[model samples]
Target: MVGRTLTAVAKLSTVPAWVRRPLPAVAGVEDFLLRLYRRTESAEALAGFIALSWLGGEAADGPLLWAAPPEERFARAFLAVADALAEGESYPPPEWWRAEAGCLAPMTEAQWNERAGSWPERFYAHGVVCALGWVLGVFDDPAIMAPLHCGDGRSVGYGPREEWRVRLRACAVPLHLRNEEIAEWLRSGAGSQSGPAAVGAARATPSRSTG
Candidate 1:
């Protein structure tokens, strides 16, 4: 079925056919993801799969999934799928999901005006990701978060402690952080000045992977 709901995903108890239509190259990946869906019916895993479909099989920004409030899981079994998807890794949920989702939720509702001439900078399909569940944000080809600072252009939206491992592609970085540190950094005016320059210097750094 096309354009189904969370309720539908849980009810039908299977990955919708629409998602698997465009996918061809990955042998058995679809079956694996589908089995995982059928077994656990996780909201986050479903959300991640939907986002993967929208990304046209290319790694865009994330494997983002919706993590319902912990309070919601008292009766539901959604987290099981998220756990299975994670295999064994662990990380935290996104910042947006943890709170009441005050402003970020509204941004997802805003008009789809992002454009890049004939190309779309954001995307019309991104609505699906938000609709399935909230996405923290998309990073083109993000670097592993070294400092774990969600500064000007950098951000993180961690999932549950157990499920964090599954959402690593969501750019889960590790670093103990403090609000005061971010405030001081911004107040010092280092964000604007050093952000891009630091990025440039990082690019100039020897390739850790190659070296």
Candidate 2:
């Protein structure tokens, strides 16, 4: 494990080139990338991090552009999903929708209720799941790279949350590595910027259960 991590750390310099935008000077961001890169043994996670970081850097980026503080909304939602997955729980739980409602200030329960029932946030949440699933090999289907259709009324294609939770546990990347990657992402400030890189439309069918 140490050797693999060292190998990943060794290639850290080259990661910047693949990212569409610059990573912020957030504390521990580099360390987070290093750990994620090491455990995943790929630069994809780093690239995703870079892409997702744009949410906090500017408001004009991705689907949440209308979000008052796109970064905060993205970060909160992403962490909710990541942490839930880490603990083997279903994501986008009812509580998550109503969580930190104050971020949008002046937002009442009724407003949160309306927003929570909306689709954009759900798209963001599923997008995070898809990105994580792809990188982790749980959604290793060839169609993963296809363009994502955010509000097209198409299904996520993933079978069920519990099913994937089992697959996540059985994946080549251990549960601890998953936890560590998320922890590092949050600690590095990248997570605070936003959660997992919402790559594109994740339509890949779930890979069969490994357990």
Candidate 3:
């Protein structure tokens, strides 16, 4: 299992270049944000983190645009869904949050409302499940998961509270490495190692493609 983790560590750098807008992190302001990222290591939160990193990555990358494939850019669309949910609104902005354009087909207002009893959980579930599709597409890239380990608030991936976190104690790859590990690894000097440099370096690379 240690072998799997080290391998995943190296591949974090090579995902199709993802692009995202900065995510809002006002404490308590984005409660569902925590649930979505933490509920399960379900790749939905993983999706959020990747998208948010792109936001930071773009900030660092600056006006110089690197063309990423449409698949990698799914983070942008997912962010819009998150932004809408955070704001407690149902209608994600048409421009950035087209559900059909993302991992799942668009949920009709009725279907969306049917599941959501005015509570955000249903919508959150829908969005996360959809986002998972995107994350799954890049599931092979450690870059998608590596940012979760970053301590830099500017780039820290959002999903820290996932189920895999618990598995860390079991010495499982936990795929969901968190900030604390980043610190511990740093102290141990093991943190200096990055994701493995190979395609599909994930603990369990999903064979399914987004298309």
Candidate 4:
């Protein structure tokens, strides 16, 4: 059965085959991620895994994945994976999510399109993380939300896994804080900055293993 499985995996298309291919040196890493995925109930986790597979096992920003402490690294990777799955779309102003007193007004659709078109991924990442912020109870705006594609096996759609939602609930730093950092990145107009630099921040707390 193991041999048959390996053979089947080997015959997949280039991208999927690369994603499913064994990493002998990182076998434990692979196993742990797969096990976590199997046990996870979070649609975000499934979305992250789908993004990971599509990325061919690398973060969207590549080496930046290792630049942060473990907790930040994990959360950023989550953000990265989530960012990858973001379907391109206009995003509302951060104020919409914060719903704070005297916050800036949400952008009009035309305004959002103009700004978002200049840096689509930044806007996309922002929307994705904001939606995640909603999930983490960090934000309150549901009026404008991003849609994601969570590919399950061979089918592509968005929905929670039937069994559990344990993953992404325990990000290293408080998820709200991390979500704010990404929001700040957009608010600051740091589009000229590189992906890692724009998204990176000093560790909010000491690093710890999520594994």
Give the C-alpha lDDT of model 2: 0.37
**Taking the tens digit of each residue's C-alpha lDDT, what string does model 1 give over 55-128?**
33232232323322222221012222222222322222445334433222222211212121111111212222
Per-residue lDDT value at 129 in model 3: 34
Per-residue lDDT tens digits for candidate 3, residues 124-186, read 333343333333443322222222322112333445433333322222223244556766867
Q: Which candidate model has the greater TM-score, 2 or 4?
A: 2
Candidate 1 residue runs with Cα over 4 Å from true position: 1-3, 6-30, 57-211
Q: Estimate each model's TM-score.
A: 0.21, 0.27, 0.28, 0.21
lDDT against true structure, model 1: 0.31
* Best-to-worst ranking by lDDT: 2, 3, 4, 1
In terms of TM-score, how similar is model 2 to the real structure? 0.27
Question: What lDDT would each prediction earn against the true structure?
Answer: 0.31, 0.37, 0.34, 0.34
By TM-score: ranked, best first: 3, 2, 4, 1
lDDT of 2 by residue, 54-76 (tens): 33434243222224333444545
Best by lDDT: 2
The per-residue C-alpha lDDT of model 1 at residue 54 equals 33
Q: What digit string (tens of lDDT, one per residue) describes model 4 on residues 50-95? A: 3323233322332111222213234434443334334445464455
